[model samples]
Target: MNSVSRRKFFGLMALGAGSMAMLPGMAFGAAKAKTSAPGQTSLAAGQAMARIKALIDELRAEGRAFAADALASDNNAQWDRLLNHYFDRKGFASISVNAANLCPSLKPVNRMAALVRDLLEADISFPMRGELAKASLGHGLTAVKDWFGLGGSDAKADFLLALTANSTMGNNFVNNGLVTSGFMDPQKDNIVVWDVNHPTNYDAWMYRKATQGWGADSIRILKTKMFASSVTEAERKAGTIPSDPQNEDEIIAALLALVDERTKLVTLSWQSNECGMVLPMQRIVSELRAVNKNIHIHADSAQTFGVLDLKLGQVDVDSIAGSFHKWPCGPKMVGILYMNNKHGAAERFTPSIWGYDEYINTPADYGFAASTGTIDPNAKRFSYLGQQNDATLVATWMAALFHTGQLHPGVTPAKIEARIHYLGGQVQQALFKHLPKVFPDFTPKTAAQWIATPTSNARLRSSVYLFKTPDGIVAGDVMKHVYEQHRFAIANLKVMGHDLLRVSPTICNNAKDVEDVVAAVVDVILAMKKKTLANNTHTRSYA
Candidate 1:
């Protein structure tokens, strides 16, 4: 009997069972072995299939039992062990802490590989694939609802899976909904957003193309100051200013002042990607609802969805758009759009991109009767946008399971949040204690001035820590030099004209990772500063 290589088996699997029949040197039955072509399979391929199938079944069952047992156990030590095991399996490096941009875990990648194998098995036909894909989507939605504690009472709220990024969903809510509802008069009506919100390519399209088409003046952005630089020097020294200033009542009041009878929609980033400043969502939503019950509130929850403990049902928002690739450690291009259907909020927006479902009538009438063409009343209406990668969708459900501890019981969303914040605190403390010593010329003295993120308020702080770079050095130049020299992955962003280095440590990181990143940053900045000074001295001698 010949042994089948793993690569060959997966290649056969990728070809699928249907395509395998057309291969030149292949045999399916035992009796045809003698007459089969060279390098072909007869009984060995069958045995390989059987062995692989058994292995898959055993692993799946064992995983389920292990998760159940772990969840049932009350031992904290056991829980910690399982958590470490999960992180170790991901094969993430400690020095690479860039979770704010994308998760570095290989768990989703491995799970996706397994899903592809399962999906290509003999029993799964095309129709069966569709059924399984829908089931996975349903599982993901249920997991999201359960995590947010919106299981029973908030049953009316539905989640729509967007094939595009979160920005498309935002556009659908802000531009399409307002235009379709006829609630906004181009001459008088306006929309409100944060001035420092992270602008995506879709935002550029909406602002330049969509708004221009509607003849609207401009999208009104709230200039709510939330940075340490926005405060006076005395306030910085006295520690009167918090890192996250958006939580203040005065800031909220000023934001609400921009909303008049003409304001039809208000969109806000629940957490700023620039500085990780978490907005007071519940308070903002409640006050906005008090002012106008019909106002459409859309939250760009890209930064806070998986990292923060969110109760979607509690917050009165028309829609919340986010993606799983960020903090959820899921596959890319998988976005979620949560529609608050309790108050008929889901019906306000028509589909921005038309699909086959949009043309179909209710009850899917295909007979000769006169049909009333209507889009689906549920989230399914947004899902039927042509062909999508079903494998990625199923992997998204697996990713959700991974986070909620259904797949592995040791790690939960709360634990992940705690780990990220703990690492974040370590980074903050290291920067505050060591930056001045390394450079000796480091200015702004106070931690408030040194750190762009919120330091005074613990509740407002997130895993994302944006700190100032040296004045003479460009943040981007320092970021590139650090990655090239030290292989550390961080971000350099300019928000509201302030260039800063962003360090977002996730659950996979440790205290040591934080210390190493801070130390590497200091070394890189110092080296760059010396080179700049030497060059300046040479130029001065020539002058």
Candidate 2:
């Protein structure tokens, strides 16, 4: 991975965030415990689960000891006493010891208690279980207070819609369906609901279940592919599919045409395109607010949780949802949601199947709402070798604290985004120069140039650079050429209507990495060109 050039980063950027798993020698595949098929016993899975449980129990004990040791070292400091009171921890005056070991810069007095809290949190942050628990608690509490004002109400609002789709989680807002629907009703303090997006698609299926609309149509909008009022017999014969964000907007527009404004919108956003483009939710919210004053915006930042600086409350984002395992390195399945006090109940959108406690009349009313029965009892749930949700949540919280300490304050989501974009642009340039020989149209185009076409400009620049090759050249051809022949890491791009080579870069990518990828792409294009020329010559001679 070292000595790689910026060009290689471009290649990675094309693959987008979703393509992270496909990288060479750094496959993001989950190391699930080897298990037997459904009919066979899963001894391996069982063992893995047992091991994880044992580790969790040990960590819990360690955490307790650490708390006690820190408290005991406090030396009867009044500040330590206050923290114990506020946080409700029974351990001795641990604040003094924590101040001594964790952060010495602080005065160690009452004024520095917050710093101590942050530091102790940082120390315990490595194992995600506890941290993730905090996140879940935060989300739950925010849900209650945001939806129902400061007091619990017996009256329930009309809807509790959760909109999630694509990078909605990254952007921390429900932009897809909520924005597409045209009326932002969630923010007006009426309903106890939340709009969220998973990095994976979750809400679309829920929508299908609720609306009884065509599933293909729903997916087509999210993928941003082909667009038609209806897939005609001829179009089906031709193998058309909607695969662009604009197509999604069109689908939304269509849905809006027939649906009522009162209809609630919920969706999950992830892997919309290989570009791995995160949602620009704050901007979307601003735009949405102009049209609908009441629209609530609850975003899912599962992928961007610890990696990106998300001031959800400051940005007027009502609620935020996220899973801990992806970037923050927290325990698996740990997710959190942040609620903005200003947005109020328009952001509380819990699933109805999850039994609603009478105490949770709205989002702004309470800190805890014990609603259960939301998930399928027998269905597959979030588990990394059977780790318990509580433990996982804690681990995620620790990861967040650890990563937050590591990142430079200057680094923002916008910066990471620019870096990836720059890498993708460079790769596209290299490919444009090299691929001319193989396919006449192998000219690499910038995301701007490719997406700027009449149909794409109004939409996002597919986070991955999408360049069209010759009409007949399928995405698989380019993918195979890069991965097998050239050994350059890249992914197939079949987003919207364009066949593109998607490259994506993440925090791990640097300028050199980008160059290595581009150089390989250059070589592949040259070889392909030579082969194309030979084939053409042979065809001419035969004719």
Cα RMSD, each candidate = 10.2, 19.8
Question: Would you list the C-alpha lDDT of every candidate in the order shown?
Answer: 0.58, 0.34
lDDT of 2 by residue, 464-497 (tens): 3434444444544655565665454455544434
Per-residue lDDT tens digits for candidate 1, residues 85-131, read: 54553454435677777765435435554655564563334333433
- True-vs-predicted CA distance for residue 426, candidate 2, Å: 3.9
After aligning candidate 1 to the native by TM-score, how far in Å is the CA of 111 from where it should be? 1.9
Instruction: Please report the candidate that would top TM-score against the real structure.
Output: 1
TM-score of each: 0.75, 0.45
Predict model 2's lDDT versus the native: 0.34
* Clashing residue pairs, backbone N/CA/C < 3 A, model 1: 243-454
The clash count for each model shown is 1, 113
Return model 1's CA RMSD, one decimal: 10.2
